[model samples]
Target: EEEHTSCEIPRDAIDVCGVQDPDDVSLDNVKEVLDSIKVLFEEDKTIKAYRLWKKLEGLVGQYEEAPQEQELSDKLMNAKELITESMFMLNQVTMEAESVFALLEELDSEEGWELAKDEAGIRTWFKQPEGSPTYHIKIQGTIKSPIFDVLALVNEVDLYQKWIPTCDLSKAVLNISKFKRMIQLCMTPPSPVNWVVSRRELMLYGYGVDMMEDNKMIAMAKSPSPGE
Candidate 1:
């Protein structure tokens, strides 16, 4: 006695069977269709497998209870096994894609982002908002140093050129309090795109903002909205 593999007809195969012309339904043709779908699954083409599975699910229903054709019955059982495997792979791929998208969103508040590249201690992530050419960029990192010492060095605008390796000149445009200021910066190897005179917002974690649980400093440079 041969070992019998038991399998149920996939829903897509049933649907395919339902929509076919009544005159066109035949055991040989249905068997051939199932064989084709099994080949796609064996080829590791998940997308194609998913598509064929759907087609098979619709068609399989018509012959599911047809106990007359032994060959057709065997082929249908094999097709079900292949379709089940294909659907599992497709589900895994979808879950992985969603997880990566969530991580990127957590990195940047903006949505519809793709990871361009990352190297060294710096991480850069960008997104084109509203289908525009302009990209919103976010960079995050940590530097090991005495907290106060680093803050003092960063707050001294006039001393920028001395410590900021790439800065040619840094001048305070306006001192808007200890928490906010506007500064003009010129880069050492200046290019038109690298030049920026922007308003800077400084948040001292322990002093005022409730979000910062530790004594950490955050600096944000204001820029125009994307596509401006």
Candidate 2:
């Protein structure tokens, strides 16, 4: 005879496994989880794994099958596995999003950047951050057009090749919301460099918001975390 071990649910989570009225005890737990996930999602819209897991949890909770002790235990174990995977994925995405902001913060500081070019009303700086082989470049220039006009032009992805230097293609990969989207940009190096470098492609997640009170608009973008 083979011996089998049973999976046990924590006393607090027993209601979630259908041992008691889920609405009574589990509602608080569900709300807590949702609130935490909501905060994370708002901070980084790329965290979709938890939302997907929550939907699955709702479907499982609504199953018509009688909740036997063993069956409930099995369901709880499966849910635990799903929650673990979802949390791991969410954490990975959150870390990547934080790194993007961290780099931006570093760039905001004036200490490390060295002026590389200053001509034709355009200024450019370059920085070789510690531990990075590649150099980070920053270009600053004033556009003569109105902010709204510039924003409109940027939002028109098809017009990128016409005005953006070395741009070969630009298109939206996903329209996440009215103001947020994931885009793909392909840049070809100029002349002889193109033969040696080939075409480079970037996957960027970007958003634009109008600050009505400040009478200004802001647009930001960064490469999305993997699997996002």
Candidate 3:
């Protein structure tokens, strides 16, 4: 009878049950940290951080069973936590940036708007951008009420229908912070028009900036992007 011999396969050579070789596991935590820091210098840090966090989170799952790399796993987890905190802080920065850009877009020029109506101390201007069926309208008027009072009236979303003749439905959909919220408004057309045209519903992102030192307050509203 020939002597029987047993041979053990090297762990690296085994490919059972989708388990990765210890040598093949590459967390690259340092590279991820560097990439996250690079995102800080780029535009839209909130979005960038979110994407990176998702990527790292996937990696964490992929290497969950990795061998002898507890330190690297801990570092990756720490990195993910840090990115989450950064995301919250970056969200505020993004909101401020959006506000600044919206202000610039609205106040950049008067060249495109054409006078549509002027009566009773109120002026209305309309601008139809190329290729867009809808028109951009601007209404200008002076309110005799104090600035703070006007600000309060605007911030009170539930009472919009009581004050604005055209608005029939107004409500706050989401409150982001003390000074910012998402609002929904429905405008009812005049008698003859209302009979034919459906109510126009608008989803707006609104925020207020108090400039007490300048004795001025600015409240801005615009359509929110899908991501928000």
Candidate order by TM-score, decreasing, is 3, 2, 1
Q: What is the overall TM-score of model 2 with all chains considered together?
A: 0.54
Q: Write the per-residue lDDT of candidate 1 for residues 1-228, one digit (tens) a residue.
A: 845453545545534544223334344454544444433333323234445445556666766856747777777776566556555434533333333345445665645766666778777777777968888677767778987787687678789778776666777777643544667776644455345644333322111111132332234344322221
Location of the lowest summed lDDT over 10 successive residues in candidate 2: 19-28
Candidate 3, superposed: residue stretches over 4 Å from native:
1-85, 118-121, 211-216
Question: What is the C-alpha lDDT profile of model 3 across 1-228, one tens digit per residue?
Answer: 955443333333223312222223235543434244233313223333333444555666666656646687677676556556555444554565556556656755698899999999998998998999999888888889896797788879999999888999999999976677899999999999889998899999976654333454566687887655
TM-score of 3: 0.55
Clash pairs of candidate 3?
none
Pairs of colliding residues, candidate 2: none
lDDT by residue (tens digit), candidate 2, 107-143 = 5778889999999999999999899999988888889
